[model samples]
Target: MRMMHNFFRIGGVAADLPHGWIDKCLDFCDYFFTGVVEYQKLITRNPIFLEWVEGIGIVSGKEVLSFLFCDFIL
Candidate 1:
């Protein structure tokens, strides 16, 4: 990840991977996270929301509103 970040920083453009790489990466992520979600379900023995937010730490609704609308005023 650091290497990819540095590559983009120096190149000043998005790095294009070979064809099918994006799809493969997405597939792998889906598989791995699916396993994690299943394990969480088994361990917790409870139903979970299919869509949920996590790790959105220390966010203020007012701050978000201000930031979102700040450009409109300018």
Candidate 2:
């Protein structure tokens, strides 16, 4: 917590707070589009990740929706 306190400043909805408020601060961390390295690691490790996915060939976006169950799990 000490390391993160200096890295970011809390304001507005987050004003004077307590140690327990650390969980609330974490709400800002919900992020998408992680980076190239992380992206590659994501798709490559996903068993259902269709490597041949290109030009919308093998499956349309709708067809793939049925298989959606889990995310990348290590």
Q: Which stretches of candidate 2 lie over 4 Å from their true place?
A: 1-34, 51-74
The positional error of residue 56 in candidate 1, measured at the CA in angstroms, is 9.4
Each model's TM-score?
0.36, 0.21
**Residue-by-residue lDDT tens digits, candidate 2, 1-74:** 54554545555333467776877656544443336668888687766575555345567565566557343331
Q: 4-74 in candidate 1: lDDT tens per residue?
A: 55566654756678899989999999899879978887656644443233444567877777789984653
Candidate 1: clashing pairs of residues:
none
What's the lDDT for residue 14 in model 2?
Answer: 31
RMSD to truth, every model = 6.8, 14.2
| Model 1 Cα shift for residue 68 (angstroms) | 2.1
C-alpha lDDT values of all predictions: 0.70, 0.58
RMSD of 1: 6.8
Q: Best-fitting candidate, measured by TM-score?
A: 1
